[model samples]
Target: MNEGDDDISVDKNEDSAVLASPEVLETSFFINKPSKKKLKKGVFNRTWLNWVEYKSFLKEYNHDSSQAACIVCNQQFSVYYCSKAEIDNHIKTKKHQHHMKSYDVNQQLIT
Candidate 1:
């Protein structure tokens, strides 16, 4: 075989040896353009002032450091991490009956 013919064959093989399929090559699977809705307008959001009407407790305790304190039991806590509902769980505990009695006595004096 002639050396020139071998070179031509090697060039043909190189052209045919595309590692990626046409689907992979034609479209970029990397960059994602932002949608018109997301880019065009600011999202409607409740400000802190607006939120205060509902999450008043969050404002009272300064948001991040806030703990939900049980009004009856005086237990200050991060409510999300707490295993059980405060008032319900407290009612099941032995001390709850004593607290109820004390609370009744206090209410009587106020009346």
Candidate 2:
């Protein structure tokens, strides 16, 4: 009928077409699968750290014995009783170093 009425109908048709498209429907079923990463065993595997060593640097995280949180930086880490490499790597991070420095300063002030 009117030019404006025609444009309105065309827009509605396009919107409906997009909503009913098979591709749009199929997209709802699409899911991204996560890839599983294989962890390489470190050389220190099978050697567990004693409580003194563990407590010196890490604290129990989330009440999970298998996970540890750094005492200085509060960074969470997996406890591989078999390996010390992971713990060593975390301790060597710049963030850990910075936090450790701050912790030492605080301790000095407290004393």
Candidate 3:
């Protein structure tokens, strides 16, 4: 067996992702081609609304979008990449608590 053969021991197949050589892999001169760049699309899931902690004020701002709205604070939050972390952080903020108290007071006055 040739010593160079060990470099490409992978089984050859039509659908194999292993490139034949480094030159073949570097055929494209462009550093960042649109086809190479991945676009991450986020979607606001309805199931997040069912969480006991978030159900009270968390809601979907748009159908199948990457955004959630806080009912108590009257604010919209992006849930891209990290969905629950963004939502839970917003709920834990002092501003949200203040808004919650104000909303409750306003509701009490109405009742």
Candidate 4:
């Protein structure tokens, strides 16, 4: 076949191949959006009755008894519900000195 005919066939094949892929139908400025709800202002909103529900959620996730280590001191702690106050206390502890140092370093970097 002539070069012109060969080029046309190749173009046709490519067009058909692209048409077979469903994703090709979607044309937009693509963004990878988060699937999970992000915590805002360090507040986990729950009513008094919902506290029990939150506890159930923790137990379901097997995190009820799990302890997160203090970022500053590397001290082990079981956290039922995490809060800014708890984090502040942990940050002040001797165990968390390293974490606090890193936090300061990061803050400096950002500034």
Candidate 5:
């Protein structure tokens, strides 16, 4: 082969060696990706419960303060008293509505 061909082959070999190196391969495969931002705690308004009045509607699940389970649907939600929108949305769900109806029927029967 010519001198130019020898130089090209050397360059290609050097590039192949770098590409096949363990450090480069490991770095490419196991990259340290940025983690998702965690939600801020205790930022909710203390008086958030006043908006929807869910205290009588939802009961605490297993006595855990962070979770509120619907008395009607039995669906649990992560509640911060300030998250009235979340509570309201869940209450509006079809499942919640169905359970509410069933609960009413049972209550009527009991009385």
Candidate 6:
């Protein structure tokens, strides 16, 4: 029709294109993230040390860390939060019960 209009003719015969989201974007955007674990709180109790043989100080797991360990079970647990409950839970475990029974038997024999 016009000088520039004649050069810009529509190409109706050409194929149409459909848009799709990329695989990388779909995975990253749609995936659910893992939940974070709860952290321990509170300081280790002073009297727990007396419960052991030394009866002087708790076997502090690490410096500046409120932690205690079960010598019978050979395991350490965080006491930074709810110190007594943490210890109680550990004591309630079957493994600790079994080991404590064996320890008592050994001690009686040694004496």
Winner by lDDT: 3
The alpha-carbon deviation from the true structure for residue 45 of candidate 5, after best TM-score superposition, in angstroms, is 10
Compute each candidate's TM-score over C-alphas. Answer: 0.34, 0.47, 0.55, 0.26, 0.46, 0.52
lDDT of 3 at 31: 48
Worst 10-residue stretch by lDDT in candidate 2?
A: 41-50
| lDDT string, candidate 2, 1-111, tens digits | 766564544554355554556876676556554557888643332234355545545655665556667878867777554346678778788998888788878988999
The sequence of per-residue lDDT tens digits that candidate 1 reaches over residues 71-109 is 445545443443234324545666656765786688789
**Superposed Cα RMSD, model 4:** 17.4
Q: List the residue pairs that clash in candidate 2.
A: 45-82, 46-82
Higher-ranked by TM-score: 3 or 4: 3
TM-score of 2: 0.47
User: With candidate 2 superimposed using the best TM-score fit, by how many Å does residue 8's alpha carbon deviate from the native?
Assistant: 99
**Rank ordering of all candidates by lDDT, starting from the highest:** 3, 6, 5, 2, 1, 4
Among all candidates shown, the one with the greatest TM-score = 3
Shift of residue 15 alpha carbon in model 2, Å: 85
| Candidate 1 accuracy as TM-score | 0.34
lDDT of 5: 0.65
lDDT of 5 by residue, 18-75 (tens): 4466878888775776667876542333454354556535765676666667777767
Which residue pairs in candidate 6 have backbone atoms (N, alpha carbon, C) closer than 3 angstroms, thus clashing? 41-80, 41-81, 42-80, 42-81
Please list the C-alpha lDDT of all candidates, in the order they appear: 0.45, 0.64, 0.80, 0.44, 0.65, 0.71
2 or 6, greater by TM-score = 6
